[model samples]
Target: MLNSINTNPGALIALQNLNATNTELNTAQSRINTGKKVANAKDNGAIWSMAKMQSASSSSLNAVKDSLQRGQSTIDVALAAGDTITDLLMKMKEKALAASDTSLNTASFNALKSDFESLRKQITKAVDNAKFNGVGLVDKSAKALVFLANADGGSFTVNAQTLSLEGLNLTTALASFSTVAEAGSMIGKMTAALLTATNKLSALGTASTGLDTHLTFIGKLQDSLDAGVGNLVDADLAKESAKLQSLQTKQQLGVQALSIANQSPQSILSLFKG
Candidate 1:
């Protein structure tokens, strides 16, 4: 080619090649720094949009898990109180049996009656206090507790088990151990109350077990969604590192080639030298 003083074709070609290399180098660095090939819509619009949707679902499930856990805890508190009331029933039954001997003196009979009354009051106290997060499941206060099971508006309900003195038909006024016949009547009531309380405890226990099983499933579902999002967007760091090194070497070579092209015009000075 003829040497020209005004323009150098080689320099223009070299500059174009160098600009191309710089663009590739910037992309490699970005993948390495962010660790995601499709961090935004510009990278891969379809994949980015899908990943965002799945991430939102996983986040919503976290709230669902929290609600289920609270429901489980409420049932646990009620179960604990139910067990305490059952034990108190057995003790009250023993007090009534002793008072029904039909041969006890007035002093002994009155003492036994007082003990039975004290134990009866304890059952009421236990029922009133079986609360969690301001909800009493076993005291006839709440009909049921419903917890979120999924992001799609599904739910699980734990029905209340009313185990109070009024619920068990063992009213405070009927608890009279002053006479042998009255003490015998109380013994029969204690047996029926024990049966009712045991059944309620079983129901609460079954609901608790169901909640635990569902929580395990929710955890697994969240993990699967997270993994799917990672598959769609996460970059291969090993591949990006190798690409970065190759691009850095090519960029350095491009700069050297541009410098050589710029010097080509200087050789024309020798052609016109004195």
Candidate 2:
């Protein structure tokens, strides 16, 4: 190799190596600090795009879960109201049976009728109050509750079952039961109403169970999508840590090598002095 005072090829080569090592060190430290192998699209365009799409899907599924939860709550409220109405109907049946006895005085029959009327009004109140998130599933004219089942706008519907007095055939006018004979006839109607209400309650319970299962599936699906995104973009911290140590050592050695290369040009000066 020809020695020159003006230019040192050795120094240039060492500087280039040092710069490369520094670049590698920076990349390793960035991975450690951010904990992401592909923090931006520039790192890996295809992987970043795929991860972003998966993340969006996960977000949509979260919304679907929320819808399912709301639907479940509505069904649960309606089921509770139906059960309470069933109890009220049983009590009303007892009162009707008592009033059917011809031996009862007029005053005693009136008192029993009043209690039955009150119970009937309470059933109406219960059905009206069985609302969740602005939806009344047991109201006299309830609409179907629809919940998103997936990110693609597909839905699951919970059909509303009315549990009101009119729906249950228990809305007979109080004035229509003036005679003990009429009160006796109401027993059969009340029994049929109770059966109808019980069936409606069972249906609502089943719908609630179905919604719960859908929610569980949504949760599991979201977890799986999240894991997939992580696999695509998450950094291996242990590997980054090891690379950081190795690059740091190389950086130090590169600097020393550059210093030694810079001193080589000075040797040409010594030759001139001699």
By TM-score, the best candidate is: 2
Question: Taking the candidates one at a time, how many backbone clashes does each contain?
Answer: 0, 0
lDDT per residue (tens digit) for residues 128-176 in model 1: 8889888879995668888999999898999999888877767777765
lDDT tens digits, residue span 25-127, model 2: 8888888999999999999999999999999999999889989988887887888888889999999899999999999999999998898888898998998
User: What TM-score does prediction 2 earn?
Assistant: 0.93
Q: Clash pairs of candidate 1?
A: none
Q: Pick by lDDT: which candidate is best? A: 1
Candidate 1 overall lDDT versus native: 0.90
